[model samples]
Target chain A: MKKFLSALGGVILLASSSYAVNKENTGCGLGYMIFKEQEGLVYELLAVTTNGTFGNQTFGITFGTLECKKPEKIANRKLEIFVAENMDELAQDIARGNGIYLETLADLMNIPEEERPQFFSKLQKNFDKIFSSENVTSADIIDAIVSL
Target chain B: MVLLHFKDGKSLIDDPSFFLSPEGKKNPYKELQATIRAINRNPYLRCKFPARAFFIEKFLKINLPKVKCPELDKFLEEIKGEKISLIFADYYINSPASMFGHTFLRIYDREKNVYSFIVNYAAQVNDTNALIYAFKGLFGFYKGYYYISPYYQKIKEYVGIEGRDLWEYELKVDREMLLLLKLHLWELKDKYSHYYFFHKNCSSEILYLLGILKPNNSPHVRTPWVIPIDTIRAVLDKNLVRKINYYPSLLTQLRYLSKHLKDDDVEKVINWAFDKSELPKNGSAFLYEFAAQYVKFLYYSKDIDRRKYIKKYLYALKLRSKGGKINYSIKPEGYPHVSHRSQRFSITYGFNKVTQYMDVSYRPAYHDLLDPPQGYKKNGEIVFSEISLRFLPKLHRFTIQDWKILRIISLEPMYSFYRPISWKVDFGFHEFLNDRGEKRKFLSITSGFGFSIGEKITSFSLGEIKVMHNFDGEMPIAVGLRIGLLKQGKIFSFISSISSGKYLKEFNEKYFFDYSLRFAFHINRSLSVRFKTNYQLVGNKASFEPSVSALIYF
Candidate 1:
């Protein structure tokens, strides 16, 4: 019961923690706002950067002022960019139902070991359609597993 | 035992001071022996500090007691997974605390899959603003503690949000060492350490906790400043990291994906993510994935409330779910580890106005526009404490040419999507040839705002305003305009600019026109050769110099 509770807490933490910290000047926050041509976003980034600009006191830490960086704001479920990019690798890992690459994918897919073999076996069955066709995505694979 | 904290150990406690404080005469080792006795008396304490208990047992030649909680046992059992990894989250420029990057440990459980737990040591701060947190961090005003968190939560923070690449270096420690390291961590779990940004930082604490694997003598932490990358280098020197892997941040992935898509496709992806009513297009995995990531970025970074954006977020998720997985990964040209240390020193030999001279320049820290861009932004540069001294053979004297106290420039090239103004601000002193052709040193303050566009062979144009306070002239302020092209090629790079400026005040209405063509070659990562030709016209009397120089970086 404690294990189950801890597991559930992980989910809640992942979701809530994503929106919790308000860090200024995610290099991409400014760049993305500018790139998206959103003036409102630019003002917000400026306001945040201005408010938090004076805190750095070390010579080593001060180096970050030169370049832009990404901000800390993400949803609970992360995208499987690696798996999505390497479908063949994903297929091979899934066929085996266990490996380094598959470990991360199964985690993102929220599939436990007991259910992984069967669910990933179905994924193994659709390997060609998934890899050869440009239309199919990791999300589609997730969709198939959802149906299963 | 005398309780001498190794203040010599750069704030890392290793001696009796680890056990006894300044009031050691009466209460020496009181807390330390109490913890030991508590573990023997209470079974729960044994479970909490199992490795520490083992250490105590071996040290005293007595078997330590054991008590186990099913919950704690379950956690240990789960952690006996495939690997132990040290995750390095590279610097995020916007966050003051993580400007030097951050390091944490992860226990991967293969059986439980992604349910791995992340162990982190950081200054516990109540301040939400990064600046205030940094202020607190720099002054050793915060209490540092180790806490257990979900691995995915860290992944979301580092990989999803910050767009900083994640480097996971797996440590191949034996089960015993791993247990001891973890047990040591548990023993120190909530204990407060005076967290200093320089010496007593995250990296040093982690290394100190894993003391068995690390060398007994400390690395350069003997000095007041300790950088994170330097610690990683020390770890490498000691051969601690067994295997390393890279994980691209979501922003990096997005940038890579956007590069592959057509302009129309990228526009469609952005629009599709923003518009909830819009139906999915032809279900290409790449487009759907791009759209999905765009919406995620918006949901995280935008001001829209969670409830309001959840619909768009789920819509994009559903759109992405409609497609099958496509295979590809973003390959950034460089990673954090490959970059040079922030401090730089250089020696150069060149000729100025028919005078042969050798110059030595030292920049106490950081990247500059002209520096090699392998591991830095191509157009962004900032430098401080840069002092250059020139020794002229003709004059048989060493003269200080320029000592830039601080300088920052952002060369934002206009793009179709973004049009940010390029700007520069420099506070420094330089030796300039006056109207009489006399070399006079002046304090120069120059700043400018301009529009710069293009890359590789860049078209850089700027109109700068200069204040020469110590100039031997009537008017010290000069306004100038310069337009030029900067070409950066593999074998060679050069910048050619033409500028004309007039003194604003009563000084002999002197107008100076100048043009310079400079070129450089990359001999290697740490060395370069440069040649320059200058044409200067000061009220019709013109002079030019052709000079060559070789620079060596250490």
Candidate 2:
């Protein structure tokens, strides 16, 4: 009975996991989140050209996460992606106690306009708590915000 | 038939096997008939040319037999494209390929807006050497291919890493147009074309893609070269764009963020960025944020590796998360299409020491330092194939004063947290006085590297090297320094420069000096008046020349 219940619990956990965090390197923190996997020489060369060349054949498959059917799942996934993509800019905006990226984050979180000031201040005050450690992932930061 | 790639009454497709008729490559009517026959006979050809099939079916009022194209269906299903947008990436001055700018299309997915797909056409270039790349790109030696990549990938590449602003012009595309676009893109998959840098480039290819939507009212480039911004203008002219959005680059954001910082705070941020000092304990959120952005800039410029970048970057973010949020917004700059035309023509009437002459000059492309700075890079000048011819009625002679094949100058001013080098290069035939004090023409190449400071009215000093041929039938080399001041204003502009070189000719070394001043008064975007004076001294002999000119840009 214990083994069956534990397996059921594992299934539930897997089902509840957002598609955004399902990537291979999701837990790898800001470094992996922002900088894509080193695509080696071809990527480097394509980047150098400024005008991108044909390097990746599989183009539209990776966007499945953005198409989550559940509203809450979509919100959570969008928040995570935005935070991961704009972490550097968001960090500065959060530290300074204000910025466009921060405003965008507040909007993504559905924080009311009147409450945004308090929310921004709260995030600013809990900066250390949210970031927590050097290797903190976007999921971790989101978890920290949720707890707050 | 309309979907055929036709140029000057001939098909642009190089492969003759693509056509079923013997003369289908040259004859569009034959190709059309062959296409109809092939599609009727074979279901696979309908799948191969879905767009052409759609057009033929709609025009002929006949239903073609359906065939399963799982790959094409899968692509269309995955993209779920509901809208199309023209994305123009602003010029990145550091790269020659992108100096004019770049354009591509973005397919906005209906369900997943953020994860859209971008259709890009670019030359397949493997050469790292700039000269070879230029040669191949200019002569259509490289094969160009269309690429479909995630929109975020391009955003990261252009906005995050390359520090180029993106202007998105969401086009007015409907369901039919979107389907047509996708079918056309499906047809182009794995196809190749000869890439021409100046004409059949990224922008022109995008224009062709857009042409599928409105065949009768397609945007066209009348210019000799297909500039990316010109394509944007053409689209705008057609009233195809519905909305516009601006995404500023990382560098632009950093600059806007640091606008309110004091000198000491900026220094502290710079210090923190370089790891020379620790983050201040009592620093404002702005200070911490500025430091983080500066570090990011460093990372993007490849000054710091990924490991170090993450560490420094995260630490700053952690500190920043402690502060209260401040409200800020970045205002968009002038649109690039509002800038004056690239090609310029001027006529000058002036007198020198010996004779009076009327000089006519023409510049084939690009902005000069004294040109209006409305939509161009400030203090930057790029001139190509600028030739000046002087006519002297008294001497009954017409002489080629100078022919500047290419000239580029980037006078990026120094800043506290961001420092960029100022540089210039010129190659062409120049008129100069030989040792005998006789007028002579020399093939010259000159390069300079140095620093510039200030804005509005800026000053620069550069270490210069000049190599000239046919100087007394011998190649002479000179090494020296040049200093200049430039002032760019809306209605008036001024520039002055002084150069001193130590010339090494055969067994003799001589000192030479040149001084020049120019002033321009702008009447409008297309018209300007200019006055210039030049003084040269060689071995105690001096010559003075002055001129007044009227300029028109088209």
Candidate 3:
């Protein structure tokens, strides 16, 4: 009898643990937080579900906008990165971003007179990654700094 | 003597005179006849004709031959008396022979006891141009008078004539003519050439004469060359390339090059002039002004695109004074410092009246951090210490093209690497748990940054992690993120980063990871509530135990 009770307790603990994880609700909800980074604005989805919800959502929140007031973090992060490296590189990165954009615009202009629309569409597909939620990288946003 | 006719209509005695036989050969008849002939030949010598005869009769005692005689003595004496009377007819005309000329003669007039003499430009006769030549020589002598005034004056007085009188009367007339000549020469010199003295090539004495300007130290009279803008440019362009000492005046010429030449050319000249060892040393002000002016010109010309560089340059020049005042008059209100690190905290909300229901959100959390890696401890006395930074306005999304450009620029990581990147840094006593599972109060500093990657994602970074040690121990390295919680339509976000300091002789050490979550409501901007829970990780730690706080945003 003792052994059976111990086994039952063990199963209950295991079930509860799993249930607790599921109840935590890892899926992001309808809200988003916006905050300023080095380059510009960035958003992140916030999870509103509490411990009682299931954790069916796998991917992190897909925020529509990132507007948050957390300056301490931004400043601290700047100090860290800048402390270990050369600040000039950061400036160069901004300049390079602007240069590339201009070059892409130039390329789009080079299309033959009749085939311009197609060229523009291709250009948009190739170069518009910085604005979309699906394809932008950290590098794209960091160097977006057009001016100090 | 040759027979000569006179204007007097008195036939000059060509035949021997038979009159005055009381005195044998006493008449000086032959000599008197010859004198009359000489006077007839030269009119200027006519005044001396009688005097010549008297001197011959009185001194040489030579009588004229009977063939040329004609009561010569008495006739010559009478002519002499008439000449003397005419000469003194002005005012006795008494000038010492020694002072005037030695060419004087005496005539015996037993009844009058007088001597008569004819004065000519005797000493002055040596010069062919007479008065003019004599005056010019005197003027030249006066040129030396300025140098030896007293000596020249003594010489003049010793000669019994006032210098001014001599200059005014005897010399002035001719000197005026010479003055006109000199004026003509001066105008010609100015209009045509600097080579006025070129023909003579200036004698050593002439140079010495001009050297009188030496004591006065007027370079205008001395130096062979005067530096000008074009000359400076030529010299600098040819050789001067670095830190040459230069006079303030000469350096003034450098600006023309700077103004007219290309930027690179100006830089080259400046660099060159700076290099020569023989350059003058008073150019600091010149160089400073030159650089300032040139840079300002470049700024206006758009050669340099950033106004910040101009501002920085001006600041370095100390032309501007800096204040902590910032442009916070816009929608957002915050003061930013030129800091390597700072901790900032703010809450802002804006809602659209056009929308039916207000959508509100609140981000409230306490953070603190350190910079320059000073230490892992936020000494309790100071609550917290941190270095922070913040961008203006806010972070936002970018298009795909922008993203690719950023990628090419390779700087998105810099922006994306901030955690909770917004506007806040905090230093204060924070709630934490000690290693023994007991509630403990410790001083802590926290900072973070957020970087946008596309429209939805961001790379987050946390800045400083320092925990004050009440006991003997070092802080631990703790960093992580927690985002899986929600309550009442609000989401909670949290990130914790900590550093474990290396152990030193009297301190035990541990790693730390701190975390916090904000239960922010998505209500309209007018009102939002944020409930937050804070926790710190102490090596292999688990989630935070329940302890929460609330913040209201207006």
Candidate 4:
């Protein structure tokens, strides 16, 4: 009985060692988000890079370390655009919007609660430049929110 | 037991002080001072006293012995300017081992104030022990003189010193000590004079130590036994004259100076010694030995410039005998920008609309079965315009190395259709009939390339331009290219192309360009799913067709 237990322990040790070796090697994490509003599916844009952005008027998001399965209320995931008249202008707008969105994310994540009011006010001014349309999809909103 | 030959036809132990120290308390320093004082105090001691005393003592001791002496004054005059040769009285010429063991000797020439120690044969003794004894003697004889050796510690040990002052040490020797040291010299002479040249099988350290303990006083002045002039002549001949190259070493010089040397052929041995060039970390020990021997050889060769030889030898010693170690080589360079030599395989389909259609040309009242079959119906008038479909599978195997240099060649086999798949009577059959009712099998041979469309996630490729000659009635020429996009797991790839060519016999030429988009999801190494879509433009027509393919990567 002791011999059997010894053999079983040896096997378990070998298996655990192999598992630890495998756990050390993991590639970059990529997540997909589906953006569906009242209308049909628009264009799906992948959020390859991200941070956070300000919203129009008094509304804005506070997206913390965003994940797809349990997305934060602030901003996360890819954005879809429905009423873009041209693809070239839309690509340019999204690229510019993502930059500010990521900055806002870094500010909110790092700033103290007392400084949040000032941070949000500054964020609002930045968002006014890119928020040309009101009918923005969730993917678009997430892009704009995290990009700043 | 002293038999002295007086200068004036008499025998005497003329210089008694030369036999023993004047202050004979078994101490060398006191005796040295007393002997010097005796010489300084007596003004006549240099010439008259020694000559007169030697004649009187010889007359008394030998009782008018029959042995005749040359006139002492004339003998003295003749030998005055000459170097005094040392004799080894202790050595037995017949006994090889004894001659070798006690080979050290003292030699001195007073007139020239030149002092040197000479050893004839020193090819035997304990290696390490002999060196220590040599250092001890050197320290004893040359009082307060600096002596250095790479093997100084070993010498000290041989001399039985636990620890010694390295920076400063005392060396003081008197007459008796010098006399005792001269015994080794006499042995060297006895050993060399009889042609019983020293054997060389002894350890190298012993020979080196022998050289070190060489005495630097002349025996002719201090002792009765002076080296015979015959022996001197022999030494000069054996050691100084060289057949080709002169090796500077007292021991080698002595060996070469031997009149009846047992072995005269030393070329091979010398060459062997020259070849041992391994740079052992402690290689200085060997170099020091070589330097010591070479210096002595230079000393004996009166004409040879000693300093120049020493400088050259030292330089040679510093050079490494052979390359020490090896290093890794550099990597190869200059690769090509495009790898046109990779083996590839692709299958593509082309679809397009044409001007000739049955709906536009057909208006038949009653069709006769016997009439030549015009496949399309347009107002019942027989009408035919150019329309073609091509399906090509091209495989290219190529190789490339440098960017500007390429040797790429490929083979592509293709199958073409002039009509749509719906119009074919037997789309899947061993043999099919064409518009002329001739049996046709669908396949052609061609060559092309595949290019990537976009990002790694998805790819589209168009193969290179290809020319095909149909094997039917007119041997119609068909040109084709393939396009494909493949994504296997995380990898995405694409290929697309277009080609046009004509057969020599047929005036009508067929052109085909197929663009395919393939997204292959590679599950693992061996399996992948390929989603493919192809758009073909033939002449002025275009069509969009999609296909699915599974790929296996080995």
TM-score of chain B, per candidate? 0.75, 0.95, 0.22, 0.20
Off by over 4 Å in 2: A1-29, A32-131, A136-148, B15-24, B109-114, B395-397, B471-473, B506-508
Best by DockQ: 2
Q: After superposition, how far is residue B272 of candidate 3 from its true place, in Å?
A: 33
Listed in order, each prediction's TM-score against the native is: 0.66, 0.84, 0.19, 0.17
Q: Considering only chain A, what is the TM-score of each predicted structure?
A: 0.36, 0.54, 0.22, 0.24
In model 1, chain B matches the true chain B with a TM-score of: 0.75
Off by over 4 Å in 1: A1-148, B1-52, B58-82, B94-100, B110-115, B119-148, B207-211, B216-224, B271-280, B299-309, B351-356, B382-384, B392-400, B405-518, B532-549
Candidate with the greatest TM-score versus the true structure: 2
**DockQ each:** 0.05, 0.13, 0.00, 0.00
* Full-model lDDT for every candidate: 0.57, 0.73, 0.24, 0.26
| Candidate 1 C-alpha lDDT tens digits along B1-554 | 11112243333432232342343324535544765666667767766555556666765666666666554454455345546777778765434466467877777745234446677767766675544565788798887766665454466567765657777777766676666565555445445677887678888776555455342433333334656666565556566678777777777667677767778777665555545336445746566556656665665566353433434444443444445345575565665556555666776776656577888888765666665556554566667669998888778888887898656666757643335567666667776556766556766667776878886677877788766656344325667888878765546777788988876743355788889998878766567777888887666566776777665544
Q: Could you tell me the TM-score of candidate 4? A: 0.17
Mark the regions of model 3 whose C-alpha exceeds 4 Å error after superposition: A1-148, B1-425, B447-457, B467-507, B514-516, B531-536, B540-543, B547-550
- Of the candidates numbered 1 and 2, which has the greater DockQ value? 2
B1-554 in candidate 2: lDDT tens per residue? 44677777876555555566788768988888888888889979877788888887876777778889866676676556688889889876666678788999988743123455688888877764556677899999988777776566677678877778888888887688678878877777666788999988999888888888877788887886788888888899999988887887877877787877788888877777777887787877677777777777787666776667778887877766665456566777667777888889999998867788999999878889999888777888878889999999998888898899877788989888778888877778898765555567877777778999997689999988776776356676788899999999989999999999888763156788899999999999999999999998776767888989999998
Which fraction of the native contacts appears in each prediction? 0.04, 0.29, 0.00, 0.00
Interface RMSD of each: 20.2, 22.4, 54.2, 47.7
Tens-digit per-residue lDDT, A13-90, candidate 4: 321211011121111111111111101111001011111122211111111112112223443222211111111112
Model 4 off-target regions past 4 Å? A1-148, B1-441, B448-474, B478-490, B498-507, B552-554
